[model samples]
Target: MSLALVLDLFGTFFFAVSGSLLAARRQFDIVGSLFLGSVAGLGGGVIRDLVLGQVPSAFDRPVYLIPPLAAALVVFFLLGSVERFRRLLLVFDAGGLALFCITGTVKALEAGMNPAASALLGVTTAVGGGLLRDVVANREPQLFNRRDLYAVPAMLGAGLVTVLWHAGMFGTAAALGVAAVVFGLRVLSLHYGWHIPRAAGTWHGSRRE
Candidate 1:
């Protein structure tokens, strides 16, 4: 019933939607759609929990896994109606990204990790699912090269949470504020075509060999 848990659940729902949208777009079967949705919803948290030496809640908690799989099923049954809202799913993914980062950091702190380590784990929790999604989808992860400020925003938010926690400002307000900043950065980057610097003289993806 805590606000953090609320955000986490909401994040799971939206990210699941995003995954379901992708699966539909790719014409994946029902099983594949469900697999992607579950991965997008719970993959990051699972990695984070494993790293912290805790049992992943999604493994036993139906609440964490149900929403995503249900979403996938919804999309499977109602493809035409759902596909129109595909664009909105990216926004949902961004929200999920921000929530997961903050929640991950907070959870790491609760698990006795130092601020720095907690922040790093936060980034891991925020992006692990997306990475897995892309890999399983047989596409390159979007975080590679200079693909807009994705992971960097997660890092920034995590860093902010660490600093605020260290400064005795650890509270719901602080966490929400930091998450908003990260989410805003991601939105602005998408709007303005902002991108990080890539390696010198390196081509992304392919060079048309």
Candidate 2:
């Protein structure tokens, strides 16, 4: 398969796994798990495609559905053992994020979008599914709250891809390199508790509801 397709599949699997884990944690039934996993796998790509004014690849292809369903099945059968797979999930998710971010930016650029708009589309592609998953699961989205270094990494990855593309370095290898760098930085951030601070005083007078 092409590198772009590979990246897309990888992203789908991890996002699906993340959603499946959440469903299992919430004690959702099999149907719920499948629905959640499928949504997580396709949600971002659908949004990305729509923003680009194209038909969603997820809807046009069957491979897009199979991986997430397979992942959900595995998670469902091994629910009690899911904790042992946490680190694995994080690694996959980070890699997927990097890949999706790069691909999103590249796709946007191909569609003649401006750099800023392309970068935003990339971030949306990377996090849209997770955001949807969180909403469906009735939990706060990590991108909106302090949890993990999520969107920042995607932004960096997309930004790098955009810069490289502008610099005439749009080869597949260059894109993969940018993705790797972003993924590495994200993993490091997670290990080191790196974070972007929220605006101070934005909630100065507010208390948790």
Candidate 3:
């Protein structure tokens, strides 16, 4: 497989695992876990492909879903056993975010998108599924929170990928470096509780003022 394909698969697996864990924590049915896992793995890619006017890869590439379904099944069977590894699941999610950011940016560039739009799409690819996952689980989307420092790292990684592409340095090595930067930023933010401050007043307050 090409390096991009490999990164796509890895990101799918990592995101699937994260979603599966959430399903397990929520005491969802096995089918629910699998559904969430599949969505988490494929949703962003579907959006990206659709926006670029391409067929969604998941439709033509059934094999791409195997890892996600398998991951859900594994988590389902070991639901209780895996509960102790919450930290590991968070790390895996970060890996998924990083990988998806890099791959999404690369794919958009390859499709001739400008850098700014490509970077935004990369953030979408990084966080889109998690947004859906949160909504389906009846929680607020994390992206709506000012305290969630997730998308910034994705933008940074995506920007790096776009820069590399322009510099003719885009390849497996540079991609990996960008992914690592995103992952590192995510992990550090999680560890240190880093976030920008929310705006001080509500929208209504400003209008009244």
How close is every model to the real structure, measured as TM-score? 0.88, 0.88, 0.91
Error at 117, model 1, angstroms: 0.6
lDDT of 1 by residue, 87-191 (tens): 566676788789889889988988889988999999998888777777788766766737567898899988988888878997888878987998899888887
Q: Give the winner by TM-score: 2 or 3.
A: 3
Which parts of model 1 have CA positions greater than 4 angstroms off? 73-86, 201-209
lDDT of 2: 0.83
Model 3 agreement with the true structure over 1-209: per-residue lDDT tens digits: 88988999889888888888877778898888888888888888888888889998878788788878888988877767868865766787788899999888888888999989998888888888777777787766766767668788888898888888899999888888888899999999988889875566564456331
Shift of residue 80 alpha carbon in model 1, Å: 3.1
* Model 1 poorest ten-residue lDDT run: 200-209
> What is the TM-score (0 to 1) of candidate 3?
0.91
lDDT scores in order? 0.82, 0.83, 0.83
Which lDDT value does model 2 have at 4? Answer: 80
- Whole-model lDDT, model 3: 0.83
Clashing pairs in 3: none
